[model samples]
Target: MKKTKILILSAMLVSTLFSCQKLVEIKETDLIAGDVALKTITNNEQGIIGAYAAMNVEMGILLNAVFADEVVTADFYNAATVHEWQYTSTDISIRDSYTAFNLYYRIIDRVNRVLAALPTATAANATDEAKRSRLRGEALFLRAFCHFELYRYYSNSAVGTDLAMAYMETPSLQPQARITVAPYFQKLKADLAAAKPLLPTDFSGTNVYRATQAAASALQARTALYLKEWNDAVTFSTEYINAVPLASRANFPGIWTDANSSETAFKLSRTASLGGRIGSLWRATSASASNIGGITWTISQKLWNMYDQANDIRFSSYAKDEPLLVGSGRKYTRLITKYAGTAYGTAAENVADAKVFRTAEMYLIRAEARAENNDLVGAAADLNALRAARINGYTPVVLASKDAAISAIMDERFKELAYEGHRFWDLKRRNLPVVRITADLPQVNAATTLPAGNFRFLLPIPNAEIQANPVIQQNPGYTN
Candidate 1:
């Protein structure tokens, strides 16, 4: 492992949904030098906790909501860079192109630090040793998870020649070149596989906030689904689904409101004190009956029309429609309520826990994999199972062919996982064009269709990274 000459005053260790928060800080400058910060098992535990806090699933959701078809922005928002798809590799604004390069890499650096320190750290007894094992598992999973996220945006194509992400396992100040996706995924799977046995299966209460065996399986299922590893996708997703079944209709809305952890396999706690609320990512910033105009970025009319607003549980789980007084008449605007702040404490509006891994997604993953593997009946069963769970009176449907099953699964994912950051990637993975309805696009003056294989499909490598690391390669169709 390359030793890093680093200066981290506090947490470089924050993570996202399904991990922890708050890294252990030291009073002195050399917190990371010669294993000063993590010289004990307790220190290692705090370090890993800090790594988990660094991740924010909202990062992906916020970017995709604007760039993808789920949202339509008005001219008033002035988010042309991202909303209008005018982003360059060099545009570094918060609302510009979607790239969490520095953030994810920072997490990888902290996780690597924990891994390096875990070996020599003092363990007083077997209990401490057991804790060490769990810490190691969590650290490995986080490192792989960060790399996977980087690949999700950075890799245009996960091919041998296409530049993917620099799969980091060591901490260093030296610049590194991007590697091919094939090897990157290879190492990603290797890390998950290694950590699987070491992690615990009990993902109850606060345990779900950490990296559990179930969370690792969830990540595996998602990774395989993207890479077209049908059998593995089914295998890993099944593991997660078996551990955490789909939420019942009565419990569905509660998942988003943080009222209950029904089908949630992993979620990051979003304390109001942290001020990490993302409900305002859109124009309205917060959604409600009184603040109808607060629904700034109206939910895409096309996508909204697809939902059974009267019956389907998800229609209400994600958003609501309120009458808007426009001119003398009235018009209704859809408000995204998925991030509706918790009743536990409503001091903050639009603040909700990042439920990263829901069992509902596993069912979809298994369905997609089964369909791709030519198991139409199995795919239909999985699809219908999730539908039955979400909708009031869903009846099973027969898929005539593989294409039909895949199409159904894709649409199901669109509605089931809307605004959770899956829409754009699902379309991209399937090589399908992003087709937004005319009603949603015209109001925002946004493009109706982002053709498949467009350069914008892959976020450009950050210009800062490209400049600092001369060896790093930028994605094609971007400027330095």
Candidate 2:
């Protein structure tokens, strides 16, 4: 007789419904037995795909922008609280935080279940074994990726200090205590190390949506950068860069519209039927209808001035100038069209594929790592390569010191990876101050500058998590 038991893992409500473009849907009733459900190659594939779908949501993307200085709200709402830096533990947008926490963990739970089941699951042939190995690697990658995201938000350390987060490895109902920052990173690295050899150099299909060997390396580089492992960061980033070359200036604009660009290492595929509201948050209903999205998060002029508008392709491709009435019938021109939604040639559809990783990021990572390691010349070369690709008639920047090179890399990251969610974390990781230019918008409070060591930089652990798990501790600033 087959043994069956119901497992409740934390606060996550594990539903059996699974669907993706490449993977077949798995129904709840069909997956009654855990062993039977994940007993086949197809079932395991669907399980991992479902985890990817859950991980690729809009809440984290929106929050990353709102909480940072990348964009500001034009209208009043609970999201505006995050924009103005006035959010608390009980704020409505805090629900978004809870959603992110739960979503990532849900991914972890799914991945763990798949990994556990894969050993016992029947594989008919060598092809099946290969698929099983790739799937296992993908699951491990997802597990590490999700945990890293959670660590960035929940953990307090800029460096790997003794900060703790609930590190769940197994699919169990037992309450888990938070692990320290170093141990959490060790686990993340271990997972990535195991995954690297198992994943393929390229995915089977035309879509680069799934995690590949390059994706694993890119993520490892990013993790290394966060951990201050400069040499390791450079090595992994270089490996990824060698595999995936940067998109030329002509092809850069197409990457956003076209899903199958060479520069995109890993991105979540979004269709009209199953899409996100990221475009709606950043884009207006029409070019003329400013602030129509309810929360019109316009780009700051400070960020706008950073680009060489005439020479740089990114400026034209990423930003749009629109007129906004500031005060007393005065017209103020603002850059409001960074993300003009997913209908490339047609009207805006308010839908876009969530960009997780790209080759350009690898270049930036390598450049930063080189700079950190005092290899300023090497850093400048890497930076110039990206600049030469993006900018017309590009002049290579010559830096006198390591500081100047580091600063240039930071600026490049801000311009290149603006809305894709790197700004806030970049500032946090470097211990740099978040100085918002509120003079442009008088509606913003005077206290706009968030110092490097401010407690508010670390988001509060969601109230739900706190209430559910007594072992979990809230971040220093937030009160339960």
Candidate 3:
């Protein structure tokens, strides 16, 4: 089967704010109006693909790593303002936050347009009907997924009962009000529920880039785990695990390079010509001088020490002990190979597919849920299952208590899902502290730790967003 051709609209077209901006302003110079673009099944399909393409950018993935303890600046660049936690609403990083906020909302708008057009979209036959339903399901999934991303970055503590993020169900020029955390999650889960039946059990024609029933289940499992719905997390995660098995130790390394891994539930299909420099941001590459992959950031020694380097396949698969040259020819021996671009079969050094969801995460989710529910034995088994697959000469850990089980699960999650954009959010959702040690590294600050309840963990809402939408209040501890 042919790869799904990326059909993204122009950035200016998709980047328009939902409030006080006419939707008609999204039209291109030669293309038809936005409304006409979604009138047919083919057009709606393109629009849905565009929504997926919106997530294909790099900032969201990189910001998560930057905020976490996984990386430190490589001395070639200064991100100290954001990296050292001295950021506010007006910082340059905040501009990237604004762009991410708008990007996800743009995805929501595109999905909403397709959903609105679906009922009356021109379908030629029963095959077209099937296509329409699948498209609708994918759109709904994208809408939920985008909203969840926004909530993770911009919202206050998930445990708090306050306005968090907006749930955009329809396209409108009216200022969208931020809903409270409870209701926002309600809407998020509803979208996934509605989408589940419409999607196929698995993607057809090798299309794991698109949403499948397994993908929806895995996302719902993640959502439930975040919400502390232990039973629901267990149910959905089990459903996903039953459908997709873990990649074996030998096959696991290939998953990073070979985009189409059996372990991946969903990933954003990226080509050298289409995607952003994701791999470059994390790894050092020889592709281009501009693609000095780890010039801005490299893996932290703290994270590197988490694995038993001799026995853990993840240590070898995700990291490299190559010499990193700094000013005056001073060289360091730690680099993160997780996002290196060599795997994408592209000449661009930093080009690699963005992994969205993997079956490995489902096992971790299930383990956490079971541990929370006091099923230590079951949780340990789940954790051991994942470890056995990723670690060489693995030993099945036996946890005798709930706390032990939870800690093991957390450690496994850190090792298993390190650079794939889960570390920071995992720390936040679990209410764990963000601690950075300056030991063995001069690039980072000396022993800075942000407690679990600190206000900075929730990013400051961009000042531009606050200015544009009066109804949207800034996150506390941030000034407009």
**Which residue pairs of candidate 3 clash?**
none
- Please, what are the lDDT tens digits per residue for candidate 2 over residues 1-480? 122233443213343322252246445664467688798888898998898888754665666677767775554344556665666767777766434677788889999999999887788788888799989899999999999888777763645566757777889877677778888888888999999899888843644788889889999999988888899999999998888889888888777665346677788876656655457666544443343333356676678788999999998877766434444241334544544555333444565667788888999999999998899889999999999999999998887799899899999999998888778778888888888775534364446777897776777777887888887777778888
Q: What is the overall TM-score of model 2 with all chains considered together?
A: 0.87
Best-performing candidate as measured by lDDT: 1
**In order, what lDDT does every prediction score?**
0.80, 0.76, 0.78
What are the per-residue Cα lDDT tens digits for candidate 3 across 1-480? 133333333434456554326665555678776668777888889998888877744666676677778786664655666666678888986685434677888889989989999999988778887899899899999999988888878763556487779899999978777888888898999999999999988653457888999999988998898888999999999998998899888788877776447678788777767645567675445544433443556778888889988988889878886533434342444667776666323476666677788888999999999999998888988988888887788888889888888888888888888878788778888889888776634354344777887777778877778888888888888887
Model 3 C-alpha RMSD to native:
10.8
User: lDDT (0-100) at residue 192 of candidate 2?
Assistant: 93
Q: Which whole-number lDDT from 0 to 100 does residue 19 have in model 1? A: 46
lDDT for model 3 comes to 0.78
- What's the residue-level lDDT of 115 in candidate 2? 93
C-alpha TM-scores of all predictions: 0.89, 0.87, 0.88
Q: Report the alpha-carbon TM-score of model 3 versus the true structure.
A: 0.88
Query: Ten consecutive residues with minimal summed lDDT in candidate 2?
Result: 1-10
Candidate 1, poorest ten consecutive residues by summed lDDT = 1-10
Name the candidate, 1 or 2, with the larger TM-score value: 1
Worst 10 residues of 3 by lDDT: 1-10
